[model samples]
Target: MSEKSGHSEKKTSLFGNEYIQHYDKDGNKCGTSEEKTTLFGQTYTQHYSENGDKCGISEEKTSFLETKHYTQFYDKDGNKTGTSEPKESFLRGKYIQHFNEEHEKIGYSENKKSILGTKFRQHHGAHPRDESKKKIVQTSASNNDSGDGTSASNTSSSGKNFILWHVFAGLFLILTYFFWQQWLNKQAKEAEEKWKNEVKIIASKVPGKWLGHASNTVVTLYLTHLYGDRFSAKVNFRGSDQELQMDFGKGNYSTSLFLTSRLHAPLYFPITIPAYNKNGVVLIFRGKFANNGKRDVFCGQLIFDQNWKILGSFQDSDGSVGYWSVGECDGMPSNISGNWEGKWERGGLWNPLEVNQTRFKLSLKQEGKVFVGKVSYIGSRGSSSLRGEICGDYINFKYRYGDGVVREYVGQAAGDHISGTWSQNNSFGTWTVSRK
Candidate 1:
């Protein structure tokens, strides 16, 4: 989980004790340190030389309030070498002051906590009298390009500190990269979830019974099966006198998603239904959501010809310019008169639970809110008496069968459609009819 140690360093945890063996850059075993914590919560780290002789010790302690902590160091033979302690300044912020064995202030290091990680800028020098000498050394080191990497005046101890500083700097960069990658991955996942939710919302509007008229041509579009920008729909093309066929388009009639790029445009959508005519004319519905009195409707025109120029009307290959709009969906319809038809279902012989369909049709003649209709079973070729009254979008009536059984029909009329339940005492069935 961390990479603060050198490649040549080996860590050992024995009997819950923290033991570490240090190694030089050349892979030579240099020294070792063993840290032990007493029951009183005091930690002592014993340092050893390459020859397995005791060299120094580091003692760490914390105040009772835990607001302050200190670590003191000792040399071989138990002599104080230095101490690194923290100091706070309102103007300068918090920093660590380093001292030599003589207990004289040598230098200070500033510790900054950032979003990336903790960073340190440490400066070390001799007494004020040796300031001139320090400048001369720095000038010489910068000028001598042929000089060895190490400074001539610095002791072996300083050399060790120099290597350790670079090691920590490298580790800092690595830590930053690790954190950045984590942030990037999190953002990508969030964007993906957002895209999925947007698809669902837009898809919900797609699946519905949409009816629109363009001149004498009547279009009934059934959008269904929406998932991730893709959906299936059946386009029923009919004239003013033509009945809704449910299936009229030739070939695959499907189109790929251009939604991501077009979603932001003023044109909310453009669905291309292909292979409509002998010349392979593609009809694209370019539209937006419109309030159709009692409900939301998808009102737009079917752009013909070239795919790119979808902004306005175009001449279709069928010799006439095209336009269409959906005036009804999920809610009540304004008009209930037309050729309305659906299926009558009952339990089948093979499976008692499975419902089977029988074609039921109604030709309604509406005057104001009341309507008298002719109900016909397709195979029988015989018509029956049907009368229904419309209240808002609801229609209910009584159908007298040929055998004198009167079934009550209660249907909800929404957007040129009526569908409800029919019942006769213990017998019941569902009836749904769509306006042609």
Candidate 2:
């Protein structure tokens, strides 16, 4: 009996000891097997062609003492063409050599096995096959005397078969990975779409905005399809605030939130704000739809950041809620408050400096929603008062040079550096600043 996996086939039979043979598409007998035991009770699988021609043989002996591997290869003429025997020690060192039809040493290789696969160096005259490929074929070859000594014409056949099999296997793995990734993306997209639809369905029943205030926080919930979700909400903690994102799937409901307490002003430019490290706040809300009720309502406990637990209720049709407010939670500060030193460049906006031509220094100070800083030309010492605000993870600042000459800077802040565009009136240029 035989089974097929991709382009390779494995055939099994009694053969006195239940050996198996492996082959490729071109009818090349790639490998054969047989079990044998010596006087010392050492048992291993032997490799040969059906006519008893030793194609290759490998035996792995592992016991309490040590583990050793013995491998040898022979051509169609029953002559020892190659031998890869371990040295005295059970180390990675191997004495590997190859011979031609005349039994003359034609090739020799140094093989070593490490964490990153096996490393081999074959020093040969003309024909050089990869030692790894030889090992792969030898490792799988079994003993089946029904087959011939692999027809010397097919000596190189095993290498070709190995290459083609790997090519097919590599392609198969790549395609499988690509399809798996696409499947994951599709599931994520479907989840996002479902959340949006649920928001809409619930929002339509409400038809208006609902506001709930508790303690020092104010909760404003909007039910509309305009802002993407059927239900959108904003939570203001004392002076810090940010929006919330909801995920409802598998009967479990939760919301991801961000703490914008350090931000003095709310950012509305990107509309959908990108999450920062400081903005990872999870709020798990659990509830179920009452099937027998007159109206749609959600009653659940609001678990805030795995800390504060509060009970809340919301009526979908009237846009009404009870005890729906999130209190203050400690969050990491922003990563953009420090002194930045780098170079600034000008485009068509100015002629004094070439594109990215001048070095500059900026001393930035963040106070709530404001960014106060000073910019000075490094070589020229010419300075200007810089004032801007943290717009999400970016800086929107402006400075005046001479005679009402204004240069506006918009840069994205990343760690110690700020890179963005500068526009003077209508002319545009680029600038970069690294933290001092």
Candidate 2, residues 1-436, lDDT tens digits: the string is 1222111122446564455453333445555555555433444445654355555443332235656332434333333444332232355233333334344454433323335542222222311112323322332222211122111111111322333466787789999999999999999999778656654543454434545443224665543334544234454422334453353222323233321223333222111212211322222222223223323233223322222223233333233222343333333324566777877655422233555467788887888657787888776756788776553454566777766666656555567677765544334455788877
Candidate 1 segments whose C-alpha is farther than 4 A from its true place: 1-158, 238-314, 327-436
- Candidate 2 whole-model C-alpha lDDT, 0 to 1: 0.43
User: Among all windows of ten consecutive residues in candidate 2, which has the lowest summed lDDT?
Assistant: 148-157
Residues 1-436, candidate 1, lDDT per residue (tens digit)? 1122121122446566434454433445666655544433433555666677766655543559987555455554454566555576887665545556566776544433335542222223431112222111110111111022211111112222333466787789999999999999999899778656644654555467766643346667666744464555555543211111112133344332221111132223324454444222334332222122111112122322211111112122222333333443223335677798787554321123767677788988888767898888877968887876654454556667677766556555556666554444334345677776
lDDT of 2 at 323: 31
**Candidate 1, residue 282: lDDT:** 32
lDDT of each: 0.45, 0.43
| Candidate number with greatest lDDT | 1
